[model samples]
Target: MTLTALRRDAPSGKADWLVIFLHGYGSNGADLMTFADYWQGSMPNVAFVAPDGLHEAKDGGFRWIGKRPAGDPKLYDDAVEAAPDLHAFIDGELSRVGLDASRLALVGFSQGTVMALHLGLRREVAPAALLGYSGGLVGADRLSAEVTSKPPVMLVHGEQDQLAPLYGMMMSVKAMSEAGIVCQGVPLAGLGHAVNAEALIYGARFLLSAFAFREKHGV
Candidate 1:
């Protein structure tokens, strides 16, 4: 299946790094592509891509799964069902861009965070870094057995977020730590179930540091 996506080519005309942004449920790629407007000038050599979700929500928006409450037990199952297509999209897009996993980063929001954690962990090769906002790990219980790689991860959530609580991110950080993966969880005070300026700036700094580290070490 062809996945529709919004792409931003590297400003340098040479793609050295690829960053794929994933949006939350009920949203489309265009919603998250706006990040490039702020981030591209900072990382001119990095390309950006944001894909629309696989399914349609009741309100006529795109989503990774069927419409359901966040705490619903079937949410995980919905993610599992949507995984294959997304996995394929990621792989194909990377190849088409002439980049490898080591030069890749996955940034996700809300439900998009669940996809980043799920697929990024189980991918045959690890990404350069993983950044998630307003989201938590979906299959934490199976991670021990299913995780194939452990790239550095940064999770940012709102302390006041009820949709995806800060506590869930805290627990995910613990799980990732126990698994020997570098994990950073930043909970913003007085923020609700949305991304704030602080979170976006923090994410930019994290990505900058990650890619800089990679360049210095040639990793």
Candidate 2:
């Protein structure tokens, strides 16, 4: 299935890096595409794409898979079942742009975060980085066996998040770290299950560092 996306080309009219935004469940691509506008000033060489989820949520927007609550044991199975389609989408986009994994970064929010961590970790070639907000990892028990890459990761969660609490993020980070993944976790005090200005700043910085442009003549 072809996933429709909103794209923003590099400000310089040429591109070197790609940042794919995956919105939370019940949210659409248009919702997160706004970040492109906010970030283009700092990442003029990076292209941004935000795609609608693979399936429509029963209540409203979209989903990467069947709708399920956070921390559900079945989420691992669901993510596994749903991964191929997302993988295809990412791979297809990368191939279309003539870019390789080194130039790619996946930024995910909520359920999108699950997809980013899962697929990013298993890529045959590691993405430049993975950034997740308000989301936790799934399939932790199987990560050791399934993981193929150890790309650096930055995860931010609201300390007071009720839906997917800070504990979940901590656990996820712990597991990834145990597996030798370089991971950073930011727990925003009193923040909820939503992104805040601070998180956005951190995310932007993470992307900049992850996708920094290195001129051929200089270090």
Candidate 3:
């Protein structure tokens, strides 16, 4: 299925880099476009895109997995099921933007974070960075065997997030390290299941640093 998206061209009229925002469960691409609005000034040459998930959520909006929550035990299976459609979307979007996977940063929120972690490492060419918010890695158990590339990752999570807490983020950090992926975990104090302005700043810096590193190394 072809995923629909909201896009923003670089202010400088040069798409030197790409930033794709993957919104949370029950959220649409338009919701995450705010990031583009806030980031456009600082990243004048970076184009942005936010894609809607293929599956529609029951309450409203869209989701990467099935409409309902499928507990932790099957979370991996759920992500696996959602993979191909998202992969196709990412691949198609990159091609359309005249960029490769390495020139992109996958910025995910909640369930979108799960997709970023799952697909970033598995892609044929690694993304410049994976910046995830309020969502930890899914399919962690299968990562060691399935991981194909190592990319820098920044996981921003609420310290008190009941849905996907800081502990889960720590676990994800461990999983990334075990798979040879470089991951940085940022735990926001007193926040819960959401992204705030500070977290957005960190995400922006992470993307800038990751892309700079990739270019410095000539990757």
Candidate 4:
């Protein structure tokens, strides 16, 4: 499936990095594209692309997968099945921008975070980093067998998140650690289920650091 996207070209004209920002459920690509404005200055050579998820929401937005009714295995399976199309969208964006997967990063929020981890882990050539805010891994149990490339991941969640909850971050970190993936979690105190200014700044720094490390080692 071809997903809609908002692209922000790098100011440098020669993009050394690509950021695929995935927005949460009931939101569109434009929702997360604003982050490009805040982050582009720090990494002039980086371009940003925020893609809309597959399904349209009832309230005039979009969703990667249908929401499960609490604990439905079928709902979870649907999410797993939908992941490939999202992965394909990422690949298409990279190819269109003339960028390699190694120089790419995946950033997401809430439901988008679930999609990011689901697809990012299974990528043939993993992204430089996967930075998620207010989100968690969807299929943690199958990560070890399904994941081919293990990219560095940073998860930032609010301590008092009611929507996704802080435990989601913990579960994701634990799963990634068991899979031998480098992962870190940052907790924002007195915060809710939303991205804050501090989270955005932290994400920018993490992306920059991950790319710099990759460059230093020639990966």
- Cα lDDT of model 4 overall? 0.85
Alpha carbon lDDT at 14, candidate 4: 84
Off by over 4 Å in 4: 69-75
- Going through the candidates in order, what is the number of backbone clashes in each? 0, 0, 0, 0
- Candidate 1 per-residue C-alpha lDDT over 112-195 given as tens digits, one digit per residue, 9 for 90 to 100: 898888888878888888999998787677778888898889999999998888888998899888888899999899998888
Query: Per-residue lDDT of 58-77 in model 2, one digit per residue for the tens?
Result: 88989986567777878888
Count steric clashes of candidate 1.
0
For model 1, state the Cα shift of residue 36 in Å.
1.2
Per-model RMSD to reference: 1.4, 2.3, 1.4, 1.4
Candidate 4: clashing pairs of residues: none
lDDT of 4 at 173: 96
Which of candidates 2 and 4 reaches a greater lDDT?
2
**Cα miss at 102, model 4 (Å)?**
0.8
Give candidate 1 misplaced runs (Cα > 4 Å): none
All models: lDDT?
0.87, 0.87, 0.85, 0.85
Candidate 4: C-alpha RMSD to true structure equals 1.4
Q: lDDT score, residue 192, model 2?
A: 97
